[model samples]
Target: MRKDRKNTHLKCCIMEISGRITKDAVTAKVSNDREVVNFSIAINDSYRPKGAEELKKIVTYIDCSYWMGSKMAQWLKKGTVVELFGRIGLNVYNNAEGKALGSLTFHTSNIKILVFPKTENSSSLPAVQKKNTDQDTPDDLPF
Candidate 1:
């Protein structure tokens, strides 16, 4: 809550959500040659209903857009987990068939990388180092 010049209190809607990236981020030039990073995340949630013996799983996918820069797209790969802080918005529009559709959108202001997906190249580094270390002798050490 914040007070404006009129001495009235105002409410701000800011949300934080953490989820796994659904796909690699894409950069697009929207207007005035400005680039925006676009990505989607899947948030997994589960809940148990009353008198239920099992838990029900739910997944919510939110489309995110970051206007700060496009360089962050390189790290925002599929399966990477990130925490985003921003505002949520709902877009309601009519489809080509005249049916109404709605989707959730997040205007991300800040992003924190939580977990990075392991790539084949990254996963092979340790094995290659281990193989080299196994062949090394104490006499090979210059020190």
Candidate 2:
């Protein structure tokens, strides 16, 4: 009884995450012979104005990660503004009191820096390249 052809034929999954970066840390290491960059991105949810009750702005934090690469980890710092496109993965962490803390990981596919972080040791991202070299190499085989 499925009559929706557009929904079945085209598979679309796009998640866009945007917020002020918080608790941003970068650590690159080889764990069990595999290299991975471990980092965290905090997303804050801003509260919308709800009528005339006179409430302050509420903020919520969400922790995310990217396992695809460490380029973002090395280039970001706390309080940096960023927009990201990524997939989601969930993980569980425990504190010293034995309580479980869970987080959703964003495996980054694309990242855009909105603003430089406001810290003394804030990281500097690599500069964007403005060169195109697709026509520099010949496609015809000489052999």
Candidate 3:
């Protein structure tokens, strides 16, 4: 008997996460003469057990590598919240003694900044002066 071939293509696994940056992004040059930005995000989860009065918070750290460019590294500062979409992967490497080590990694394809850290002088900008006029302006305008 022959088997059916309706859908032979494997499904892709994409991961999406939103969290705050644990630290500033770092750029590194690979062997292929390409630069990549590496950073980590902290995702906070909270849950209360059945009939519990206190909230329990759990933080998960995700290691991410962005292949877009090093320009994005400047925006990924510590305490900045970001949303990322990418594919999850496991990086496997051998130790000095030939021991295997595996780590959870995320290869980010898209990233968006949600919030940025506030600066001390951000709200101290001088106010701009506007032109004063007594005439009323028309409200009708053409598209």
- TM values, all candidates: 0.75, 0.56, 0.68
Put down candidate 2 lDDT per residue, 65-85, tens digits, no spaces: 555665557666777788888
lDDT of 3 by residue, 1-143 (tens): 21221212223677788999998899998857799999999999999989999999999888999998788897888888999998877656666666666666778999989887665754432333667654565576474
Candidate 2 stretches greater than 4 Å from native: 1-12, 30-33, 48-51, 92-101, 119-143
Q: What is the alpha-carbon lDDT of model 2 when measured against the actual structure?
A: 0.61
> What is the Cα-based lDDT of residue 90 in candidate 2?
58
Q: Tell me, by lDDT, which candidate is best.
A: 1
**Rank by TM-score (best first):** 1, 3, 2
Candidate 1, residues 1-143, lDDT tens digits: the string is 22121212223577899999999899999988699999999999999999999999999999999999888888888889999999887666666666667778888999999987888766522232335665566756777
Which sections of candidate 1 miss by over 4 Å?
1-12, 123-143
User: Which candidate number would show the highest TM-score if scored against the true structure?
Assistant: 1
Query: Which residue pairs clash in candidate 3?
Result: none
Q: Each candidate's lDDT (Cα)? A: 0.83, 0.61, 0.79
RMSD (CA, Å), candidate 2 to true, equals: 13.4
